[model samples]
Target: MYAELFRLDGRVALVTGGSRGIGLACAEALGEAGARIAISARSRDEGEKAVRHLAGKGIEALYLPADISSESAAQAVVKQAAAELGGLDILVNNAGIARHGDSLDVKPETWDEVINTNLTGLFWCCRAAIETMVAAGRGSIVNIGSISGYISNLPQNQVAYNASKAGVHMLTKSLAGEFAKNNIRINAVAPGYIETAMTQGGLDDPEWSKIWLGMTPLGRTGKPSEVAAAVLYLASDAASYVTGSVLTIDGGYTIH
Candidate 1:
């Protein structure tokens, strides 16, 4: 009976940016736990492939297309997921973009793009999902954040990304406080130097990798599945009492 608390059978989940990297990994993990999945991405082909992969694992998954940078598009995604998947019990805000520029040279347009996609888009999805979830009286939200929110990466400056992620941390807390009465929980997962396509450049540089490993107590970069595990834990009833929390899956990179 206790084991059932961790089971996600019959739960419906919507994961933004679910075509690849951390989002796809979370989708896979949740699917394995028996949750029906709606994998949303801007790339139709990738979204279809992700859904197929999940389906192959015996999980009911659907491909929903949305570019979360557009507020209207983000809202539409939640509506479609709710309509098609029956209702959403989980929402993972994993859609984000990272653009690097000198802090002083970063243009307003780029800053706006990063903020719109990473922070504002997350709000739009949460707002839409909450409409149905509030009526349902139960839901779980996991916002994918990054260690860069707390500490900036050297060499490349991404002030917009850092600010957006910091906002995400507070956003999760604020939403959790407001929605706890509705039986809805909101939490965030901050990942450190994960080995994803976005970070391949850093890993390819032996000197950079050495510096990264030196900073990371684990002496290695993290994998997407590791971040997915953190998400799965927060999504499941195993974290029923957890809300307004930031679970860091950084492999000790933030300790120093």
Candidate 2:
């Protein structure tokens, strides 16, 4: 019974930025649960590699090369995924970029790039997915957010990233309220410091690693699979009654 609740048989899922990091992990988890997977990334090489990885696990998957920051690309990826996979049942807005610098010194282009990719692009993906889901009368969206949306991180200056994720948190709520009547659910997962390629530079720095571990009650950084598991629950029937919620997988970092 428990397993059945999490099974995604006959469902189709699209995961953006799925070539690596948390996105790839989410795709793998959803595929393992029996969902057909479509992964989109800016790099064709990375996308193909991700597809190969999923295939090695005996999961049916497709690679869609796309830059989600472009509205046309975002819409096209969703349309192609739906056409190829039969339909869209789940959407994971996991593509994001972060730039760290003093707000006073940050370039306009840097800020624009981060906000556009992290927030605006995600909205486009959600909007496009909603059209199909609403027609079908059922769908689920699990956005990958950051605990930075909740609390400012020490020693790192990422005002743009924090602000963008905060936008995502609210966007999830607003969309959920509007789409609930259509049998569509929108939610987000706010993960703390995870060991991913994006954070490898910081993690490799002894001082940064020590500071992060000290702040986290778990005493270590989180793994991509850990975050992926939370995403899986939200994407599956297990969360039928859940919506407009932000599940924090932060290893007790916000306790203070």
Error of 1 at 253 (Å): 0.7
Q: What TM value does model 1 have?
A: 0.97
Count the clashes in each prediction.
0, 0
Estimated TM-score for each candidate? 0.97, 0.99
* Per-residue lDDT of model 2, residues 70-149, tens digit only: 88988989989999989999999999999999999999999999999999999999999999999999999999999998
Which candidate's TM-score is highest?
A: 2
The lDDT values for all models are: 0.92, 0.94
Question: In model 2, what is the error at residue 245, expressed in angstroms?
Answer: 0.3
Question: What's the lDDT for residue 3 in model 1?
Answer: 71
Q: Clashing residue pairs, candidate 1?
A: none
For each of the candidates, the C-alpha root-mean-square deviation to the true structure, in angstroms, is 1.1, 0.7
